[model samples]
Target: MRIVVAPDSFGGTLSAREAAEAIAAGWRRAVPGDDVRIVPLADGGTGFAEVLHTALGGTVHTREVVGPLGDPVTGSWLEVDGTAYLECAAACGLHHVGRADRVPGAARSATSYGVGQLLADARSAGVRRIVVGLGGSATTDGGAGMLAALGLVPVDEDGLELPYGGAALATCARLDGDADLGGIEIVAASDVDNPLLGPHGAAAVFGPQKGADDAAVAELDAALGVFAGVLATFAGREVRDEAAAGAAGGLGAALLALGAGVVSGAGLVRELVGLDTELDAAAAGGGPAITGEGSFDWQSLRGKLITAVARGAADRGIPCVVLAGQVSVGRREAAAAGVDSAHGVADEFGLEASMADPAGTLAELAATVAPRWGR
Candidate 1:
């Protein structure tokens, strides 16, 4: 019998690669001759570079760029499959900031200059399609810093270069586009559909998670609103209303200002990993396939990555089991998503205990299900 074990990152506990290895180890102990393939995957958020490199055979390019606090940090992205994948978090993620430094007003000074630097490298290399994995963002400057790096000049009232940060958007009076994006197909792979400036906007929704207080969130929201108005003034279009404008700290809107379109982040990951073909092969092999993420919530039923994975398995007539660190989704909802089983690792045990001794737990689960499938 053949089995494919594809798992995503368990957030702070285990990487997708590590999780796959642990599960494979358990299976090896249980059924020694079972054909098992390990594919470490990500949904275009935290482990985006690793997943793209695994799926597309890419090269990592690192550079020193501005962090969320304007500090110099080494950030990296990938260039492969005729495209580059960039996630702002590698260099300027919220995790980089200390709990004390979690001041939203101060964190607003975060700059996505590194993200632009990645795009610049892709463009300079004559790369055509660039899929930006938009997640785990720290800066909430409405992507102005990223755009500024890409040659969108933000001028102060006196037409001087406005300092990087959403707070400076209040002074953004003029905008000019002179970036040399000669041959770049930018795709904004976004996970959220929040508008640019509203209750569900970047600041209002995701700000608190990133350490923003009520007042600071409003301030950031207002600043992003200003950035949107200025950008719309030049683009002659409403940037705030864009479906994914709130993604990546409103960097989605920044990319939109540059003529990029938003697609499901999971869709991009699925295509990169050849999920459709993988599912077909899994069905033919008569083996069960599993894929999951850190959490399975209502969002998964949307265009989230796990749903796409489940959809691929369903299309191939394979029973796909979704094993996550935590599951808050309902049966009716998950059934509609075509997930045959929704198992929560958290429900079984704490993440640290479960992953620290993953082999035993995996073996137990496998043995329990082994008889049913004649393992």
Candidate 2:
């Protein structure tokens, strides 16, 4: 039997590529004669650029850029087929900030300026199109820092530039200067469809995840509202309420202001990896496609990488299985989402053991599940 193993990163424990490889190894171990194929995926977050580069055979360019907290950090982008793929997380992702440091001060000061620098770099390369993977960011500045980096400086009443951070945007009276992208086609690859401001907007929904308290969330939201107003005037249109405008902490709004289009991050990754075609081929051979992430919860059902993979398998009439770090999603919900079976490393092995050896425990779980599914 042929088994297709595809998984997103196991939280921060393993990368998508590593998770796929481990699953494939365990499946092969369970049944050496069975053929196993590995396909890794991302949803425009942590592993976005690496996963795309692996599938597209691109050149990865690395540069030193400002991180979320105004520190210098190494960042990279993928250039493939004259299209540059930029992952926003590489510049201002929450991963860059330590958990202990994720207090209100850090949350209020995070900036997306590094992402704009990357966009500038891509534009300098003369790429006709640029796809920005927008998620896992740490800022709620309404992309003010990004716009600032791109020459749309946010200024106070005194016409002085505002300091970096969402809180600083509260004092923003207007924007000085304009962004010049040279007319390059920009695409914002995102998973969430939240708008830029409101109850379901960036700060209200994602601020806490980046370490904002109740007060910080309120402050950031109000500040983002001010930033959005100024940006609407600058762009001659309103993008604050557009779908995905809240992604990457209002980076989506900034991109929209620059005439960027939005696309499903998971869908784009699946297409770039040819996951549907692979599922079609696997279906012909009668095999179950396995996909997973760190935690299989309610969030996984809402257009995440695993959901995209399961949908692809379902379309091809193939069974889809999941082997995740933990499984909090109910079986009924899993079935509704086109997942046939779900296994958890933490359930099989204790949480301590699973967290200690994510790859090994995941491989063990895959090996255990293989005989039942691989048969």
Candidate 3:
């Protein structure tokens, strides 16, 4: 039997590649004769540039840049064939903010300045195109900080630049300075298609995850509205209601203002990683295609990396199995999303053991499930 093992990063515990290798190792342990192929995936989030670098063979460049909370943090970008692949999470992800620091004030103040610095570096390298993976952000500033880093400073009525934070955008009167992209093609790779304003927008939907309270969410939303109005004026068009304009804490809106195109992050990653081709090859033999993430919850049913892999496997008449750290998704929901079976390491080995050894527990779970599906 030929088995395809593909999975996204299990939160911060293991990378996608590590998870894939662990699952493949365990599957081989269960059935030594089986051919296990590993393919890691990402959906424009934390592991975006790393996974793409693995598949595309790019030169990874690292540099110190401004972090989410106005401090310096290490960031990286991948360059290959005149294209730069950048992960927004590297600059301003929620992971940068410690659990203890994840308060409403911090959430309101997180910035994407480092993302602009990365873009500036890519442009300086003369890349013809840039693909920005936009998710896992710790910001809600409507990309005002990013724009500021790119020379487009947001200022108040007193002609003073506003402080770095979403709340300060409420006092923003207009933008000072110009952001010159020099004809580079910019792409916003994102999973969500939410607009930049209103209930389904950036602050309202994602602010709480970054630690914003109800009041902060409302404030950030109103502030983003103000920034969007100014951005529309600068862009000479309206992009506030555009699809995917809310991605990465309205970084998508900023990219839209820069005339960037939006594409599904999962779809792009799937095509880049050649997942369908691998699934077609795996379909020649009879075996299940396994995929997973940190937690198999309602989000998995959306267009996440696992869902993309499952759908690809399903299209090729291969059963899709999930071996996640924790599985909160219902079986019926899993089935509806092309998942044949879903197993959780936490459920099988208890949360304490799984948390202590995520890779080992996940591997054990995969080994336990292999006999039922691998043969």
Candidate 4:
């Protein structure tokens, strides 16, 4: 038997690589004579570059950049075949903000400056194309900091530059485009399809998780409105309501204004990693593909890594099983989402034990479930 194990990172616990390895080990233990293939995956979030590097054998480049809260931090991107793959979360993600700093006050001051710096560094590498993974952002700045880092400073009526963070967008006057992209193509790999403004927009949907209070959410939303309006004027095109324009705290809008194409993160990574070819090869052996993440919820069905993988496997008639830390969706929902089978570690070992050792629990679950797969 041939089994392909592909999974996203289990949140802060097991990374995709670790989860794939553990699942492979368990599958081997259960079916000693079976062939197991591991293909760790990501959805343009925290581990996007890492997973891509693992799959495509890219060179990782690290650089020093500004953090979410105006601090110095080290960030990295992947350089593969003259294209740079950058994960915005590496420099400006909520994960970078310390627990002590995880406050509403901090959200107001978070910036995407590091993301800009990373892009600049990638460009410095002489890469003709740059792919930015837009997720896990800590800021609702409407990408002002990123624009500033790219030589487009936001200034007030007094010609004074606005301070960092989303709150400063209220006083912005105009964007001064000082640097040119010089024909480099930029692609934004976004996780969500939310626009840059309104109830379902960036600030309203993601602000609370970033530590914004009710008032802050409202303030940030309005500020993004101002920012979007200004960006539209600068670009001479309507960009606020573009699909996925609200992704990554309105960073999607910024990328759009810069003429970047917005694409599905999971889908982009899958194609780049040649997932179809791998799945076809595995399918030829009459093997099923197993993929999953930390949770199998409604969001997981919406263009997430697991969903993309499952759909790809399904297209080729390869059964795709999902192994998650927690499976909240029902059998019908899982089936609808193109998942052949869904197993939760918590279901078998209880939530506490599963949370304590998710990797081990996943391994155990894989071993128990392997024999059940169609021979």
Candidate 5:
């Protein structure tokens, strides 16, 4: 028998690769003869580089880049088969903010300039294809910060450059001096397709999640609206609230302006790692496919990686099981996302005990379920 092991990162407890390995070990112990394929997944978030690296046998490159708060932080990228996989969180992740510094007014200083630097490096390396994964960012500049870093100049009425952040967009008079981005293809990786402006826009819908207060959210929304207006004058089309414009603090809007294509984060990762093919091969050999994530909330079924896995497996007529760190939905909700069954790792053990021995507990759980797979 064959079994496909694909799961997302278990948040702080374990990475997707580690969790998959531990689960596979347990499944092996329980069902000795079963052929298992481990396919760890990510939605372009914190653990994206490592997960993609493991899946594609790619190389991970580390570099020092300006963080969300302008401090130097270690950033990373995945180079697989000559394609650069850029994770926005590596440079502008909200996790970089300290609990003490978790103030919305302060986070307003955060920008995605570091991501522009990463893209510059990738361009310098002569990479033809670049895929940017957008998640866990700590900025709301509508990608203006990133654009400025890539050599685009945003100046005010008096002909002085403005500071990076969404708050200053209202003062932007003209966008000057384009960059030398020649023949570069950028694919935006995001799950949410919200527009860049308005009530449901970036600042309104997501600013609070990044610690912004109501007033701050309103200000950012206005700023982004102005920025979109300026961009429309240049691009000759209104990009306000364009699909995926709100991804990564309006990073999507910026990329959209630069003519980058956008796709589902889960779909991109799956195709990049050949995950669906692996699952298909496993199902052909007669075994169920397993997939999951750190937490299974309502959004889990809303175009996330775990749901993507279940859909792919189900398309092949294979039953898919899920093992999450925490499962918040019922069977109906799970099935709505094509999940046959879903269970949390915490359900099998005490929360404290599980946290202490996550790898062991995960392995043991997989081993317990191995025999049911006809192994």
Candidate 6:
């Protein structure tokens, strides 16, 4: 029997690569004669660059850049066949700042300067194309900090450069376009589709999760409006309502201003990893494909990595089994979402224990569920 194991990162627990290895290891333990393939996946989030590097051979370049809170941090990007792959979370993710250290002031001052620094570095690498994975960002500066790092600084009424973070956007007068992207192609890969402004905008919806209070959310929204107005003047068109413009705290909006193509992260990753080809091969051999993430919920069914994997498996006439940390939906729901089988490690091991050692627990759960697959 041939089996494919593909999984996204389990939040704070295991990385996608680690999860795939653990699942493959356990599946083999249950059926030693069965062949298993490990394929890790990402949704243009924290592990985007790593998964792409693993799927396609690449040269990783590391650079020290500013963190979300203006601290020095090391970041990396991948170069594959003259194309650069960069993950925003590598520089501005919430993981860099501990929960205990995430004060309101820190949230208010966080910037995406490091992401901008990384883009510049990628451009300097002489890559013909750059794909930015916009997810897990910690700032809400509307990508102003990134622009600043790229030499496109925004100035206030007094002509002094504005401070870092979303708070400073309220006083932004105009953008200074001193930087040039040359002739490089820029693409933004993201899973979100929210516009840049209004009730469903970046600040109103994602601000609280990043530590903004009601007053702060309102302020950030207003500041983003001001920023949008200034940006519209330069873009020669209104971009405030464009889809995906709210992703990664408005980093997607910045990419739009640069005339970058916004694409679905799941779709891009699936093609890059050759998921469909693998699924077709597995189906021809009458094998099933296993996929999972931290949680299998409504969000998972809504065009996430697991959803794409399941669809690909279905198209190839292969059963898709899901092994998640927690399964919030029922068996019927899972089937309706194209998942043939669903199992939650938390259901068997309890939430605390499952989260404590997710890789090991996931391995154990895979073995328990192995009998139902690859007869």
TM-score of every candidate: 0.88, 0.96, 0.96, 0.94, 0.89, 0.93
For every model in order, what is the number of clashing pairs? Answer: 1, 0, 0, 1, 4, 0
Candidate 6, 1-375: lDDT as tens digits: 778888888876889999999999888888887888888999888799999998898899999999999999999999999999999999998888788666666667789999999999998989999999987788888888998999989899888998889889999988886668889999999867778887888888778778888888888889999999877876787777887788888888878887889888888998999887778778877779999988888757655788888888888888999999999988888898789988899998999989788889999998888877855
- For residue 178, model 5's alpha carbon misses the true position, in angstroms, by 0.9
Give the number of the best model, judged by lDDT.
3
Record all residue pairs in model 1 with backbone atoms less than 3 Å apart, i.e. clashing.
68-110
lDDT string, candidate 1, 77-135, tens digits = 88876777887677667766766887766656777776787778678777778888777
Candidate 4 lDDT tens digits, 156-221:
888898999988898888997674777899999987788899988998988988888899999999
Evaluate candidate 3 by giving its C-alpha RMSD to the native, one decimal. 1.5
The predicted structure with the larger TM-score, 3 or 4, is 3
Q: What are the runs in model 2 whose C-alpha is more than 4 Å off?
A: none
lDDT string, candidate 2, 64-105, tens digits: 889999999888899998899999999998888988988888
Please identify model 5 stretches exceeding 4 Å from their true place. 29-33, 57-60, 80-82, 198-200, 347-357, 364-375
Give candidate 2's whole-model lDDT: 0.89
Off by over 4 Å in 3: none
Please list all clashing residue pairs in model 6, or write none if there are none: none
lDDT of 3: 0.91
Q: What CA RMSD would candidate 4 show?
A: 1.9
lDDT measured at residue 229 in model 3 versus the true structure, 0 to 100: 91
- Tens-place lDDT per residue, model 5, 1-375, is 889998887766788889899989988888878889898888766677777776677777788988888888888887877789999988888777776766777557678888988888887887888899887788998888888888887788898998877888889877788867778788998867778887767888779877789888988888888888877776677777577888888988888888888888988888978987898897798858887777787757657788788888888888888887778889998898888888777787867777889889878777766776645
Whole-model lDDT for model 6 versus the true structure? 0.86
